[model samples]
Target: MQRNRSKRYRAAAQQVDRAKAYSLPEAVSTLKKFPPTKFDQTVTVSFRLGVDPKQSDQMVRGTCPLPHGSGKQVRVLVFAEGESAQAAREAGAEF
Candidate 1:
């Protein structure tokens, strides 16, 4: 079933070419064309996959490490011993 969208959303959707696949640079450039808004806006991208997301073998997992840490203190559980523990400590892990 189709969900109702705001007139603003419908207008924005019309700006995009539904048939086109955009590169990251192209997507960023397209976003720049939109007029400024009073409130903060969040952008979300969704991709429908052909494979079953529930299947263990088809599960997607990845990590994006921050360059300068998250600013908040991180709590870590260690399962290392000897040199491995020392190496983790040297890599900015606090005890």
Candidate 2:
């Protein structure tokens, strides 16, 4: 199925050649060419490996260092009542 992309995404996509694999420096320079955004943006890089994950020898592994840390929202679920509940709320847990 064809997916609709925004004008900003379309313009950025056009800068890279999909048919060719870009080197580290090539990728960095291409991204540097883009205009800066008003707010902080996160960059996610994913590698496509040809190895089979089922095989013990070929374990899918890699870590992308997010300098700004993971944009993960953490939620706490407390199953307590009375004083315990009050303490949890004080510790930043949403009731």
Candidate 3:
């Protein structure tokens, strides 16, 4: 299905060469140059691995913590009442 993209998105897309495979640094630089949205956007990187879901041995899962933290800020929600709520706040829960 075709969906309309914002003018900003179209403009940003135009800046990158679709046929070219950019180095990691070059891709990041291109992304940083894009126009900002009204609200902050999450920077995501996705990969499509052809491993079959039915093959347990081929499943992928791992973590690589960056030496410098990711630029994204994480917001967490806690559901509690009275003392629990206060405890969560004291533990640094944002909301």
- Candidate No. with top TM-score: 2
- Stretches of model 3 off by over 4 angstroms after superposition: 47-61, 66-95
Sort by TM-score, best first.
2, 3, 1
Model 2, 1-95: lDDT tens digits are 99998787888888889898887788889989876767788687766779899999999777988777787878888888999999999898885
lDDT of each: 0.81, 0.84, 0.87
Per-model TM-score versus the true fold = 0.45, 0.49, 0.48
**Per-residue lDDT of candidate 1, residues 1-95 (tens digit):** 99998777777788899899888788889888876667899788766667787999998778888787777987665679999998888887775
Native-to-model Cα distance after best TM-score fit, residue 27 in candidate 3, in Å: 0.6
Q: Which regions of candidate 1 fall more than 4 Å away from where they truly are?
A: 1-11, 48-55, 65-95
Q: After superposition, how far is residue 48 of candidate 1 from its true place, in Å?
A: 5.2
lDDT of 2 at 53: 90
Best by lDDT: 3
lDDT of 1: 0.81
- What does candidate 1 score in Cα RMSD to the true structure? 7.0
